[model samples]
Target: MIIRYLGDSELAQVRRRRWRKVFYVIDDDLMRLDDDRSVPEDYRQRLLAFRQKRLPDILDLADVIVAPNERILEGYPSKKGERLDPCYVTVCDDLRHFDDYQTIRILFPGSRSHLNDLAFLQEGLLRLSAAHTELEIVTYMGANAPVRLKGMEQIQHRKPLPWAAFQKEQQRERFHICLMPTVATPFNQARSINKLFDCAAVGAVGVFSRGGPTDGVIADGVDGLLVDHDVMAWEKAVGFLIDDMARAKTMAQACLDKAGLCGNPVRVRDFWRKQLDI
Candidate 1:
């Protein structure tokens, strides 16, 4: 089984080779293709001008089309012959081992590209560290992390490690949490649910913005906490968990239990197999 990404220019390459199965990750509505095309002159008004003859051509070539999340799947064109399904995987390193520290650790900073927006998380961390003198806040340093974070300077910063080491380290901690604050935009609205799965798998409490696909998975005050995009809210939430160890532990256990049922890789794979009819 060879997996290939079918993009605009790369769709033709799949035909050159033969494979048992091919998967394409579809992310847009076929009806909205005109909005994406480069054809000038009243493109919005000329919606009918751009015939969708090429859509079937693309779909016919694909053996299986995978949508990463429910949002992506919802946006996909549903037709009689089309076979679209959610077959996305959370590609984070498996953290099934390690049992050491009893301190809380937090992982924020969405991606390397938007480190500036993530600076607030570092600020929150500083405030957290100050209130709890004995707390150990481990910050995973991404390859593109900024030089410094206020109040986190004293907090231990570990270089990005191999998947095995990283997962081992993550599981050793008492709790793990992810804080992601996405700026309001159509593009940001398309965020993936993998972060929730990733944090849940390791029994880490997940903290995220109420926007995007997070709402579908995280139930505030239930499985995880949802915060407004304000730094104060983030700080308060983090502090609450850090101060209340028992509640944090319970939430972590709940996350682990839920993740085992819903985000299990084997279960996810079986879902894909059923969807793809393989």
Candidate 2:
């Protein structure tokens, strides 16, 4: 399994390694970097170069390309003409109880790459916060979190964590709701709802963008909520959860139940075993 963004020397070393099967995994939306202003120019240039050049070589060498969804596979077509199951695969069991809760907790659980998507929800978040004094918003963006929003008494920001640490933290802490809002760009369009899995892993009700991958999958107003690009819509979805804590708690458990069944690691392992024919 080769996952890192390696330099030429490292790439050559990877090629020289002896292995029965090679896998390349892409857990992000790597499309239309030039149009995404949030990405720094130099870094964007480097990413684009890698996407155009090194990606082909890596795909050619990889026995299978494991990705979060079909859109990514379509965006970066492989010679095999197929993509593996996303394999985000799992759920959290010991979920947080909502009874006796004083404050409504909401969190934006994403890395710097998701800042643009999170920003799309800023106005709505502000409006929602204004309406409810008991609401507490936690963000993982740290110093990079939106300045205006971070200054609010209800908003608290934490520094981004390493991948392993983030997963552990997801298990440790609990929030009532998780937010995923995205603007319509090729970059955002090609992304997956790994956020949906994250929502389940944290055992929180998810509020997703209507046109994104989570749209059809979420079963809105049941296990989760879906909002359009409208700021009022975003505010409304969250407001629904705040107004009805019992349903909100039910939805969170339903979301986790769905994840455990749909994203079972055992099922994933079996699928891969069959795919590998071993």
Candidate 3:
């Protein structure tokens, strides 16, 4: 039986209803449960209390629990003889293909929630634009993106494309690269598979930070180039590719071939089939 916490995405709800034929665990918001006190009066109190009392029992009956990340698994203890059945799927969508543009396409927008570091992207794009007229840096800026770079000709701000469309665009480019320059932080260290797979699947060589989850996906100077989180290093890597098309194509092909083994759904499915004896 497939079960999910209520109030999740409509797509998930529809899937659960259609395939599993099960009831969703309708629970009131429990974000306050970690606090020391009970919630104040609310219409959801009954649902909240019921969930608090019966969640463990519900989990015990579940054949498999899909947790978004490892942190969620911490709360659910394994029964004495029963192994915990949990699986994780990265939220990022698979890559698609779009049209080809002549200029080098560098997509390096900072983390979605952090608006402060946009200046790095703007400055980096501006410097690259000045150095090479053939470069086109496309970034989707939020409503709060800095106004200082608004008038720059080469820096075009389009409406943020959906992930699928963005992946398609990455595929179409003759040369595309994803730059992730993370300021050292615990949060930055835990970035998921989105950036690595997105670029690699579409044959774009990644210029990623030398550490973090990216390190697991990228091989230094092999599938893609890895560099310290420094602006000069970023410029050199991107510049070398822009200047040497043959090397860039070779690296891009290597990334695409390697990504097929690492992130391809068919390969991943086979891996689990062997491990789980499916």
* Whole-model Cα lDDT of every candidate shown, in order: 0.55, 0.76, 0.53
What TM-score does prediction 2 earn?
0.89
| Residue-by-residue lDDT tens digits, candidate 2, 1-278 | 66736568867988887877777777555666767766435656878888888877776668766776677666555434344434343466755558655888898886777777778788888988898999989888888777677788999888989978888888777788999886776667767667877888777898888888776678888888888888788888888899888999999998887666556677668866876776
Per-residue lDDT of model 1, residues 1-278, tens digit only: 22322345565666676766655555433343444432223532343332254445555655655655444445544522223322223323333322333545566524332344466566676677777775555555554455556335446555656656765654554345656665544434545565565575455677777775567676788777888878889899988876775676667666666555556677667766776688
Q: Give lDDT for model 3.
A: 0.53
Clashing pairs in 1: none
Give candidate 2's total backbone clashes: 0
User: Candidate 1: which stretches are off by over 4 Å?
Assistant: 1-13, 18-22, 26-64, 70-102, 113-117, 147-151, 160-176
Selected candidate, larger lDDT, 2 vs 3: 2
Considering every candidate listed, which one attains the maximal lDDT?
Answer: 2
Which TM-score value belongs to model 1? 0.65
